[model samples]
Target: MTLNLPQLRAFLAVVDAGGFSAAAAELGMSQSAVSHAVASLERELAAPLLIRAHPVRTTALGERVLPHARMALSAVRSVEQIAADATGTMTGTVRLAATPTVCQGLVPGLLRHWREDQPRITVRVFEGDSGEVAAWLEDGTADAAVLIDPPPAAARAFPHADPGIQLATDEYRALLPRDHPLADEPGVDLRDLEDDPLLISPNGCEDRVRTLHRRAGLRFAPTHRVRDLATLIRMVQAGIGVTVLSEVSRSLIPADLVLLPLKPQTSRRLVLTGPQTRPWHPALRTLAESAAGHLAPTTARPAEGRPLPSGTR
Candidate 1:
């Protein structure tokens, strides 16, 4: 006896979609063709696999065979993914997740580069907090994710193809209104803000901010709790309260706000994370390399009177 993948797929699709017509639409096949495929599958197995009802259901034997069929299909797809990786062809959709800051600061450049390099590949991005990003990856909702200050155990749990590909290490900076008394000063310590009414965004960075405060033996009781990044910046612009954010986030600050480096020099590393066990797509690997390039240090230029390095351009 011979088992056909198409027939099995058709059977599964019908069961999944709950009707032959819906499965036909999903598979881009005529209803008659899908019905025929299921019929052929039944003939091969010499038993009825599905009950032809409004919402189709599997028979006892079909339920017994379903697991093996799904496994076979998954194995076949894995083999195909391996082949695609070996050939270095960037095709298919890549589901990606990242925090709003990274999406605003870095992903646009990566998208532009990807468009020019591999137009065949489509990227779908989802914005979420670091914890949500991890949830997306664990639930298979995203092929990969960009995380800020990911816990050490998470790295061990979901190791990527390029484990140490650091996208960026952004230093935390103090955002103060230009009219503030200490705005003109170079830097300020976290302890100095104890008396001031602080404004902190309740987005993904809340935990990180709390941790930083906790380390300083302080607590964060924001005078105003802001949820949106843009709104928070506008509030700071209006001199509502001071806030702290990463260096990359400075781009969002208006001219009236001054960005000062934190006195203690706190920073967080953003890393690209991928599935630990699944075979990663070549496009994802390529993306990882591109992301790492963003943080690659540039060579210092030679002084006008000094000798140039051999490979200096």
Candidate 2:
């Protein structure tokens, strides 16, 4: 049986975008067209691939086919990139995933640089929680990602995959209500806020925050666990409780909230990485290399807290 590119792409798009309508929007196709493509693909394969529901899900067969579908699409992209490279004009879309903090604090500058340097290559950004971002990269939903202190095992999973490039090293800071007693202090220790309810966002920084408490010999108890950074900030503004967040998240903090250095400071490395389970796109490789040179000396900061060793992941 003969398979087609559009049919495969539609299948992958629906899976990645989570629904036919959303997939159509992403593919710039009519909903009927996207639905038809997937249906046609299923007919060719003689099995149903998706379980149609709100935020559609893949059937067991579809799950088994997903990796092959991604690889097939990636192979096509590689061929196209090869032709473009031979012409000395590289052009391709790179789906880049990042946590909300990186999206707000770091991505704009990187986009600006890419726009100027690699005008033909399109870079699309996807913002999610840290776990979601990593998952996207691993699953091929994103071509590249800005990862937060990715573990060593993630890199080891794909020996030939592009190693992560450090984008920035940002210290974690204590966020407090403006009128709080310790808000005026130059720095605040986790112990200093022990009596106050500790607010923490479980999006990406929860483990590091837990590590901080452990190092300080304090319990890892938190008063409220927030998932969204915006909601967390609003909670802090309304005097719900103080929280710890990356220094890069300062832009999201309002004037009424104060961000002070965390005593015995800790920092996490924000690294740009390609897919661990697939070949890197040519444009993605170029972007990764460019980022390493562009951000290295400039964004690197001395962390008073124990920093993860270089090339840790």
Candidate 3:
């Protein structure tokens, strides 16, 4: 049996774009054409690769095939880049994954800079929760990812990926209603908020918040578990409860809500790294280098406070 690039591209586009119609739009092809390509690929392999559904997902066999497909496509891109390099032009697409917080906070500036500096290279942003983002990098859905306080063991977990570069470290702060009692303070301690209901979002910072509570000898219990940052902010604005979030997330919070530095402040580092199970796409190296220059390693301290100690991994 013979496989081909168009079939593999169609399969990956369908998976990444989440549907044949969307994939066709991204690939600038007819939806039926994309579907036909995927079907042709499945026929060649003699196995169904995708589970046709609303969102479109990979089958068990597809999961096993994803990394190899990504490597193949990336290898082809590398070969294309070689030709482009010889002509003094570099071009390729890089898929970047990040948690919602980083998407809202850091990605905009980075994308803006990349757009100006690397005009030919395209960067696509995929925003998800921490676990989903990590999985995307591991499974080859994303070419690179910005991870929040990634554990040291991640180096071992993603042996094929580059050792991550420290992008930025931002401290966690208290999110409270404007009129709340602690809102008037320059900084609030975990113990100080213990009497009030604690709201927590399980995005990327839940574990860090739990650690903060434990360090302060408080329980990790949260009165409300919110999954979306906007909804969590709305709840805080409505006086439902107070929450703790990173300082970088200030853009997402409204003016009516107050953000105060945490006493004995804690911070989380953000690292940018490539996919774990595939060869680095040619454009990812350039993106990383641009990011390193665009974002200098610095701690995002609160406006009202000095830098605090770093949080545990």
RMSD of each: 8.7, 4.5, 5.9
Which pairs of residues collide in candidate 2? none
Tens digits of per-residue lDDT, candidate 1, 24-93, equal: 9867899999999999989999999998888888899988877676556556655665676678654665
What would the TM-scores of all predictions be?
A: 0.68, 0.85, 0.85
Off by over 4 Å in 1: 1-78, 85-88, 155-164, 217-219, 294-313
- Residue 51 accuracy (lDDT) in model 3: 99
lDDT, candidate 1, at 202 = 84
Which number leads on lDDT?
Answer: 2
Give the C-alpha lDDT of model 3: 0.81
What does the lDDT read for residue 66 in candidate 1? 71
lDDT of each: 0.72, 0.83, 0.81
lDDT of 1: 0.72
Model 2 residue 58 lDDT? 97
